[model samples]
Target: MSKLVNKSQCVVICCFPANYTVGLTTVVEALALGIPLICTKNVQMPMDIDHEHCGITVEPGDMGGWEKAVNYIAENPDVASDMGRRGRELAEKVYNLDNCAKDVSAVLKTLIKK
Candidate 1:
């Protein structure tokens, strides 16, 4: 899946059971690879995509909305590319391991000081 995702133009993450939140790893990988995404709204990282304008989100179980989002991306290559770029930027800013570790270390230090 990693290899395939790396080479893909876009990724679609469909969460099952309508309300379950999953697929964070796939979302991270897609963002790291600068691939635009079409994702179900119930997934764990919908806000990451929405706030960053990194992808299109559809309500879970809404097949029509999903299809429409996919078609919109397919027809608008430049828009899709921009979304991919934004996704990569968001990933670097928010999900980078070094930055995350630094944030955790800061919190721990504050707690220890108190």
Candidate 2:
């Protein structure tokens, strides 16, 4: 998943569970890899994906949103490219795998210490 985002030409991640919290991991990954993203509001995507600047947000299961998102990226190459760049930068700093590993390690260490 990370590698795809890192090397893919573009990405559109649609999530289920309307109330789910969207993880910005994929979006961030795509961004870091210079790939554009299209996400939905079903979950709270990390801050970067939340903003339309980094990607498009569609209402879950809404065909219109899907079309619009796709169209937006296809029609506006500059915006999409810029967004991919931003997403990549955000991912490198905030969603890096090392950062996630460190956070998980801290939680486990605390649990063991307890």
After superposing candidate 2, which stretches have Cα over 4 Å from the reference?
1-9, 18-25
Tens-place lDDT digits, model 1, residues 1-114: 678767776899888744435877788878889999998776445455766889988887898998899999999989999999999898898878997789889999999999
State the C-alpha lDDT per candidate: 0.83, 0.72
How far is 39's C-alpha from truth in model 1 (Å)?
0.8
lDDT of 1 at 103: 83
* True-vs-predicted CA distance for residue 72, candidate 2, Å: 0.7
Off by over 4 Å in 1: 1-3, 17-21, 43-46, 102-114
Q: Assess the local accuracy of residue 85 in candidate 2 as a C-alpha lDDT between 0 and 100.
A: 80
Supply candidate 2's per-residue lDDT for 95.
72
lDDT of 2 by residue, 1-114 (tens): 566556554688877755556555566556667777787775444463656467777777899889978987888888888888887677788778898899999999999998
C-alpha TM-scores of all predictions: 0.78, 0.77
